[model samples]
Target chain A: MAVLDRDTINAVREGFTRHRLSWIDTLPFLFAALMYFFAARYLPLGTQVMIQVAFALSLDLALGYGGIDSLGHVAFFGMGAYAAGLYALYVSSEPLSGLAVAACIGALTGLVTGPLVLRARGLTVVMLTLAIATMLHELANTSAMKPITGGADGLFGFKIAPVFGMFSFDLYGRTAYWYSLGVVAFVFIICKLVVNSPFGLAVRGMRDNPVRMRMLGVNVTARLVTLYCVSGALAAMAGGLSAQVTKLVGLDSLAFLVSGNALVMLILGGAGRLYGAIVGATVFVALSDRAAAIDPFNWLFAVGGVLILAVRFAPQGIVGLIADWSQRLGWVRR
Target chain B: MAAPALAIEGISKNFGGLRVSRDISLSLPVGARHALIGPNGAGKTTLVNLISGLLQPSSGRIALDGVDITNLAPERRVGLGLARTFQISSLFPSLTVAENVGLAFEARFGLDRRLWGRVRSRPEIVEGTAALLQSLGLLELARKRVADLPYGQRRLVEIALVLALEPKTLLLDEPAAGLAVSDRGALLDLLLRLPEALTILVIEHDMSLVFRLAQRITVLVEGQVMTEGSVADIRADPRVRDVYLGTRSHG
Candidate 1:
């Protein structure tokens, strides 16, 4: 205690605050910016990649950072899609307003499902998430809900107001591309804030050892639920963006494959890194588009091959490689 | 008894037909230094688990500062100024030692749910975490990941984490379970120097450490209290020797 005066303690405390946002964190955004400006012809594909990045980023928060293993995250995504779609049909056609509604619905979906899904761990968590997603998918397809959900045919017919009521969603998808990119950027920043925050540290701590966290008076389950809710909201935002951009909410939005694909993207890019989502989504969407165009019937073969290669070579994700490189470069502080 | 800081009344726990704690009762008054010693399979850890709300007793009530908390969640009990260290060191391995201690410190300030900003931006929590680590001689290890630390330092970090809670009642389950002699000496000194008003219940197999730390010692046999008395009384009790003390190698 004698050695720990005000200055000494402050110095030690200063250690925790050592790593702030660095130039390296902005590299991914810079890449995206370059793509936006230089590769404007591929805006439609770029928009799809951004939406997937947003979705995968949300999954990374829940499964990677929060230690919540959800195999059915598409439930929130589909809910967001429907929230935007239904809002457009019955409420207002404004895209921003619809996206906000979608985000709230995603958060609401999380609040409802987090308690049920987060209470379990490992296989049970997976089953519960998958079950919820399946149930949502079935409900959307049910004829009883056909008038509202569009049943199996998909939800459309509602026109989305232009960006700021100026930039229309053109045939080239220029506006939708930029809009989704903005949403993805927003999601990335949120993840960054959370990762550096006390709440994020607590969530990571709980994920590492929940029993120890409980002993420290941390309501582990409650914190987890909150994280799940946030992740859900973000995932829903991605869904809403998809609906607005594509102008269609399909049964596939809630499909199990979507959740599986999101997980794949996260795993391939690295689960916990914010940039991992960006890298994963961009790579996944690009690969899918090329494979589908080259050989439409067996595009899964290309995805499956890439996934296997990613799993075998870089199990920690592509972002993990960058981290190692940064460390080896002798410039990264931590 | 000056309003005991912790009271366990007729606490009993069973696993199907097997009973781990049987009608056990103990009271630790405020500022009391109490130790519970028992032979292996005597359910010493079970009693600690029951008190800490990790395991529920089939029939018993656990109270902290005179409030019954028989059904409180483990985290709820911790919120009411109860903290504990496990016999085996448990920590967030990937995080730095500062982060581990900082998480506990922030939780005390009800900042665990604040999601918007960086945790280190807060001056109070950072200094509090630093002061706690510095006091424990763990300042140099602040940035090191817990997974890379040696076993001895891990135990010290566990203590740091527990103390960050500023608990009124502390439960140390073999605080020096696997430490070397030098580490054990350090731990003994640390335990002896804890706040005078903090009630402590330490479960240990090391008799010398127990003797130096406990004002009163309770010996348990088969999940039931065999004897409860001052340190001298337990040291001289032949039955305690026959059941527990005699069975283990003396320090």
Candidate 2:
């Protein structure tokens, strides 16, 4: 975590100095930072929003940049949460170590399964991923692993160390929000750099025409596998963050419902665009939280209706919608 | 003995029971402008695909400069000095014409991973792409997205992309497939003026362009080489007239 913070801050500072950073590029980070700062000061929402955003970004990279539509991403997220929870129970409550264990476990799982899942394209890939996630969910619910995973009860009573041995996590939620925000920011920057690189362009080319990319001598399967593992690591990191802040982990974290919601968030924000992930996560989580506060079961219906409308009318999602409108108004042009 | 730039010996390709290319044998010598002309479905494009490594021939060998490149991938063939332009314009639609050309230069120059740097600002890459675009009469459209270009302009961009690779051997799959008569003439003029070191094998349906550009013409019929000769000989051949030229007489 310390290394991540230093690297992220250094990269951000360098990026700021080197390029004339556009508002669109800087807007999401600023918005996230401001929201976290205010929420830490005024609210008690913990780090749920930050964790959701991180998960959303990971999903966007997988589906958008890597051009693999996954309906089983929550499998990695749940695995990470459980791995972190189990590590905390058996090894240490230190958040950093737990996060590391979670990420490694998630990455390994993705590496093993990614080839099989990625071999199939389009809806078959989606179905296979969904099945994988469901299988994980069921396995997590088994009695054999219940001692560590807690089965139906899930893992509970996990603890987190103070951020960098300085500020302890307290009821004020400052420590939790800042820690998650810092991690999210770090991962976001890394993803941004990767997606903008030549390797990233190759992936985009694959999306446009796989045959052409293959003809270009790109090892298509290997690239997809690498992306899958990275995405899994990021998703796991988000899960670890969630487990640390909430101090509990559940089987539902790996459920298809959770994964489906993340996909919906990605599409609602926009695919291919990184900022779309954050926007989708923010809107989806905030709206769900708000509507659920008013009506639990029916809010999902409203969300579903909105998703349908979004798919039909604004297929590019919110960021795309805004970009289009801005272009029309001559306020900004790409 | 120096082998030809491209040697296609006894090459055959089949789709199901249908033979698209049958035991086709041809050798493109260095600096030669060889044209392959046939009616539609005469296997002209199929032969190009085999030579460019887009499809593997079912039989025989493809050797480049005496080195066998029969099983090499398309990009590897490009690396071995084999570059091709497609029948359809295959430019990156979202990219500017210069950027589209630059990508080909970048690929051939092994600079695909030079991320975090200003690729478009690279002096050599920019200059080379610009020069190629100018040669193809696409200098004005350099900064414009390929999607916005007219079909003729887009075709020019595609040829420029192939030229930017600095290939020793070039395969053009109907370079003037879809263009106005004037644009076709302009393209043929541009082709004639290219550096003589670039050995070219062109598949063209337009007889006037083929007669004007090709040093030698190979007439393909029913997936086999029906005849091969100079333009004047091909024009006078009774078999060539009966099979290919005769069909176009009504038009």
Lowest summed lDDT across 10 adjacent residues in model 1 chain A is found at A11-20
> For model 1, how does the per-residue alpha-carbon lDDT over B14-42 read when each residue is reduced to its tens digit?
99999989999899999999999999899
Instruction: Put down candidate 1 lDDT per residue, A127-197, tens digits, no spaces.
Output: 99999999999999998989989988899998999889898888888788778878987898888888888
Interface RMSD of each: 2.1, 12.5
What stretches of model 2 exceed 4 Å from their correct place?
A1-20, A33-46, A90-92, A97-121, A131-153, B113-128, B249-251
Error of 1 at B148 (Å): 1.0
Best candidate, lDDT: 1
- Model no. 1, DockQ: 0.67
Model 2: what is its DockQ?
0.22
**Global local distance difference test of model 2:** 0.78
Clashing residue pairs for model 1: none
Give TM per candidate: 0.97, 0.87
